[model samples]
Target: MTPSQLRSRIKDENFCKNIISYLENIIKEDLSWINPAFEHLISVSSDMESTIFGSVSNCIEDKENTKHNLSDEDKGEQEYFYSGKM
Candidate 1:
């Protein structure tokens, strides 16, 4: 799948939130090492921003597919939860 599709899938699965949470947890424990990482981040921000924006735009354009993917995933999760298989 395209990068945009992968991003949309991640968003639909709430993967980004989990990843952000994980990153926050890591940074909270090691505040001192964040500077070099933050510096590299700033340097890459511009290029990454365009890629992200493009992916979001693709997601928007294929919103119906994204919605279907999300709904089906939700259904699967719900079924698994109800069946005690989660």
Candidate 2:
């Protein structure tokens, strides 16, 4: 799923809790069958890592390209700044 979808899913407290509970149960049950579980876990983790890193790299590239294309005056604009009120 995309980041937005993931964000929406995470916003639901019950869904998040259920996911945590499910994962905990899986770990508890799989602890005895280390071989198969370890292989599956490693495969899932590697895929996730690749997806996350690719997204991050794309974001960084986009930001850099935007910066290069901006005028000197626009470059000085604050994209992010602290709100003292908070």
Model 2 CA RMSD to the hidden true structure, in angstroms: 15.5
Segments of candidate 2 deviating more than 4 angstroms: 1-32, 71-73, 78-86
**lDDT tens readout by residue for model 2, 1-86:** 89899889998999899989999997778456568869988999999999999999998899877877877666556343223332
List the candidate 1 regions with Cα displacement exceeding 4 Å.
1-43, 64-86
Clashing pairs in 2: none
Q: Model 1 residue 4 lDDT?
A: 92
Q: Cα RMSDs of all predictions?
A: 23.3, 15.5
